[model samples]
Structures are given as C-alpha cells and as structure tokens.
Target: MSKPLEQNFVELLEQHQNIVHKVCRLYTNNYDAHNDLFQEITIQLWKAFPKFRGDSKFSTWMYRVGLNTAITLYRKSKRTINTQQFDTVQFKISAEEYDSTEEDQLKLLYNAVHQLNDIEKALVFLYLEDKNYKEISETMGITEVNARVKMNRVKTKLRTILNP
Candidate 1:
C-alpha cells in the first residue's frame, strides 16, 4: 500500500477501533480469543479498505466488515469451549462506570448475550449500538423486515435468559 493510503487507513482505524473491539467482545469467549479475533478483524478490514467507497460513514463500513469477519472468518471450535469469569473479561466498560447492582446486571446481560448464536449475537450488538433496521439489514444483508423480526426474537430470548 502507498504511504498516504496506509496513513489514512491507520487514522481511520484508530478513530473507529472501538467498533472492532465491540464485535470481538461479543464474538469471543475469553481474552485470548478476543485478541485473536481483533487481529483477524483488523487484517480483514485492511484488505477490504481499498475497496471501501466513501458512500457510507467509515464506522458504518467498519461495522459491516468487522461483523462479517467475526461471523465468517473467526470460527471457534464448538467442542472446546473455554469459559471465562465475567470479571476477567475486559470489555469497554470500566469498574467505576456503574454501581455494584448495575455492574451485576451488566454482567448478567453479557452472560446472556454470550449464550446467543452468532447471528443472534450480531443482531443484538447492532441493536444495542442503536443501528436502525435499515442499517442492520445493510450490515447483515437481510431484509429490513427480517432484521426487525430477528431483533424482536433476540430481545424475547434475552428476556427469557435474564428471567430464568
């Protein structure tokens, strides 16, 4: 890659790296898996960057690429699941951000989210990020109605998981 293009890529990636982190956290079970998925997502984003037309916001494009990489390229072995304690998992949230009760609730929510299938997790991630149905459909390559339906189902599933 040319220096200017490389520089631009670095700048954009630095600016929107949180999107990658969010996807990685949702997709992976532990710290090592999170780091691996983050690297893989970054590589995929770099490879796809040249083809990124300036049509959508860079963050929007990043979400599409990052989510696709998480769903398709970074598959985990179903037989060898490694669970980590919620406290050990480092996400964007910090210890001081919430009170103990809120922290416990957040942990429960993340645990419930981790139980969802890949597609369902992606839908929940986008929904939590405030992506509209159109943006969710564009990112996931599903119809808007399908996205809505899936999101509703995911919410119902989450409620059940939390309540149970």
Candidate 2:
C-alpha cells in the first residue's frame, strides 16, 4: 500500500473498528477464530477499498463489505466450536446503567440466531443491526421484497426458538 493509502486504511480502521469487531463476534463466537476472521475481513476491505466511491456514507459501505465478508467467510462450516475461552466483551452503549434482563434477552436472541442457516443468519444479522430492506437487498444481491420476506421468516423462526 502507498503511504497515503496506508494512512487512509488506518483511519478507516480507527473510525469503523466497532463494525469489524461486531462482525467478527457475531460470525465466530470463538475469540481466536473471531480475530482471524477480523484480520481477513480487514484485508478484504483494503483490497476492495479502491472501488469504493464517496456516494454512500462510509459506515454504510463498511457495513456492506463487513457483513458480506462475515457471511461468506464463515458459512462453510456448520459445527459450533466451544467458546468457553472467549471473553464476553462489553460494547459501548449510551445508557449509564446496564439492564441484565435486556442483556439476557439479547444473548438469548443471538443464541437462537446462531441456530439459523447461513442465509437466515445473514438476514437476522442485518435486521438486528437495523439495516433497511433496500440496504440488505443491495448487500445480499437480492430483491427488496425478498429481503422483507426473509426477515419475516427469520423473525418467525426466532420467536419459535425463543418461546419453545
């Protein structure tokens, strides 16, 4: 990488570190794998950085790339490795106080989402991250209607898992 591009790369990482970390955490529950995937995603982003235009917000573009990398990179294996050694990292939330019930519910939701198929998990990830149908469709290269339908199915599946 050229000096200017290297500086830009570091700046991008500094600005969007959370996005990459979140993708790694969600895609690979194991810390070692998560770190490896994180590195790989960063490399992928750097490689693809040249194609990025300033038309969209940087976070939006980063989300698209990171989500795509997470989904495609980790979809090969279906086995759940033990994550006992992985430390539960805290996220930066605006609230001054933490709600254990809400945290537990979120954990339960992620656990159930973990049980979904690759495609379903992708949809769930985008939905949980508050991505709109259009963005999700663009990222996944599917129709907006398809994104809505998939999200609806994922919600139903999650409800069943959480309730049952």
User: Which tens-of-lDDT digit does each residue in 1-111 have in candidate 1?
Assistant: 899999999999999999999998887777777899899999999999999998888888899999988888545454323444677766565768778898788788888
- Each model's C-alpha lDDT? 0.86, 0.77
lDDT value, residue 94 of candidate 1: 72
Model 2, range 61-112, lDDT digits (tens) per residue? 7877887887777655656533322227555765456577776776777778
Against the true structure, candidate 1 reaches a TM-score of: 0.91
Q: What TM-score should be assigned to candidate 2?
A: 0.84
Q: What is the alpha-carbon lDDT for the whole of candidate 2?
A: 0.77
- Model 2 error, position 13 (Å): 2.2
- Candidate 2, which segments miss by more than 4 Å at Cα? 81-87, 90-96
Best-performing candidate as measured by lDDT: 1
| Residue 54 Cα positional deviation in candidate 2, in Å, after optimal superposition | 3.3
In candidate 1, the residue pairs with backbone N, CA or C atoms under 3 Å apart (3 or more residues apart, or in different chains) clash, namely: none
Candidate 1, which ten residues in sequence have the lowest lDDT sum?
A: 74-83
